[model samples]
Target: MTAMSPTPHDPLGAVLPPSPDNELDTLRELVSSTYLNHDPSLVTIRAGALFARLKALNRAANHATRAHKQATADSRQEMDHTYLGLQNLLYEKRHLEREIDKCRQFASVYQDIPVHALEDFMQIAPEEAPLNSPNAKGAPQLDLKRKELIKEKEALLKESKAQLATVENVKTHIDNLMKTATDVRRKVNDLVQPLPTTSEPGQSTPAS
Candidate 1:
């Protein structure tokens, strides 16, 4: 029998010692009894069991992968929602800040202007009726009072004018009466005076 030379690719042959006859016989007997003469039905049953176990593991791995993906998606969605909410809040904060800044600017610009309490303003300001509210109770009262004052003033003026006319008439009548009395007195004095005696071209001496 010719011995086959070890090939270059046979790494085990280079390191291992030569097998004894007893070891070689034991190996051959194990192969023939366990593998070569094994039952076909038993091998098929074991293979089926192994294949079913592999399929179950594969299914478990797929389910775990799907669950992980779903969890990641939900987490990402939650993060996005939180980010949007934060952005909205930040925008509102900025808007409020701008409004506050404008208010401050306005206040600074008008700082020198005087401010009055509501009560003080109410006290000093003129009372005006509300627009388009002619039927308001207070407005009607004020209008009535003003009308009454105007009517009273007019009545007073008319009375004064009539009194002035009456006074003028009395003064004219008094002046006429005074003139007539003076004329009567002058005529009585003239009539009461003795007539001047005149002697025609004669000198008469009378003792009185």
Candidate 2:
């Protein structure tokens, strides 16, 4: 049923009573969707941040999906429920959406598969916009390079220490060789000296 158009004269506007023709069907459809109407049994088990993220993702995914389907629709303002799923998908690597399981076993697959094209189309330029966001596109590669440099520096430091130790050992060997050479020179000088007593004996013989 068509929604009664808002009129200028009616101070209260088109206050159409909640009927099957208009409001009732809309409510029924909303209730059927897990994102909008959650089962009481499931809500009981909700715990921690993950549960909250899943719920928000479920709702946001639905909003984006619908918005996409109705490409020409001028959706109402203040209808930002779609952001819940989008931000989670954009930031988190993984999440479990309980609502979208009925139709699409994996409801929040968008989180895993970032919609870079959509984000670009929407001109969303935040760092966490999507995997394809220019800001984050090269970060993972840079991180890998940084890790490799750290490893290389550590290896070089180890090699330098080994080289220094070898140089010290060589110096010690050279000092020992120098001491041995000095002792040999002193001993040769002592053996080559002439005897002083021989001169006195020769002089006495000449006199006789």
Candidate 3:
């Protein structure tokens, strides 16, 4: 006996259950068989079912395509945003590195310069009187003091000059007196010289 092929209603060869992998082939065979059997009612019913299935499949495919396109666009936008963020980070890192390098250079250049602590500097620095204080000497007071000191110095200088001039006059008078005494002594010596006696011929002299 010959074996019979499976029909649409008995698609498993009457021994096994139908599988999803062969469903399209089974449908094709069913369509062909219906046309070959020339049954109008069966053809009309199967055609309607096939058309509905095709429409459902088309709708599902269109939805999947739209979802895929939307997902791709979203992924691309996210990637762009991430790339921009990375670029910004890199730029900031470079700027920071440059700033650090400049700081290092400055440190090396000024290495030998002294750096005083704030407390030490403050301790050594001169303190100013408060502006609001009643007795605080302002610029006008300082100027007045300076003028007084200058006037005193000028008076002292003039007095010193006068004293110097007096000392010079005294010295000149002493020098003139010394010269006059020398002249007088010379005149007295001339006047007091003993008369050279011509008693050499007489041969007589008075004893003192």
Which scores greater on TM-score, model 1 or model 2?
Answer: 1
Model 3 stretches with alpha carbons more than 4 Å out: 1-27, 33-35, 108-110, 113-208
lDDT of 1: 0.46
lDDT of 2 by residue, 18-117 (tens): 2222332343444465534676555444422333443444454444334333421222111233334334443332222222222244233233543334
Candidate numbers, best lDDT first, in rank order: 3, 1, 2
lDDT value for model 2: 0.40
Q: Which stretches of candidate 2 lie above 4 Å from their native place?
A: 1-132, 195-208
* Candidate with the larger lDDT of 1 and 3: 3
Minimal lDDT window, size 10, model 2: 194-203
Residue-level lDDT of model 3, residues 97-144, one tens digit each, is 555455444433233544444345446656773544554425456556
Clashes of 1: 0
Candidate 1, 1-208: lDDT as tens digits = 1112443222112222222333334434544657667777775665555445544444544444454345445545554554555555455545545554554444332236444443454566567834345444355565566566668756655665665565555456545555554554444343233322222212335778
TM-score of each: 0.36, 0.30, 0.41
- Give the alpha-carbon lDDT of every model: 0.46, 0.40, 0.47
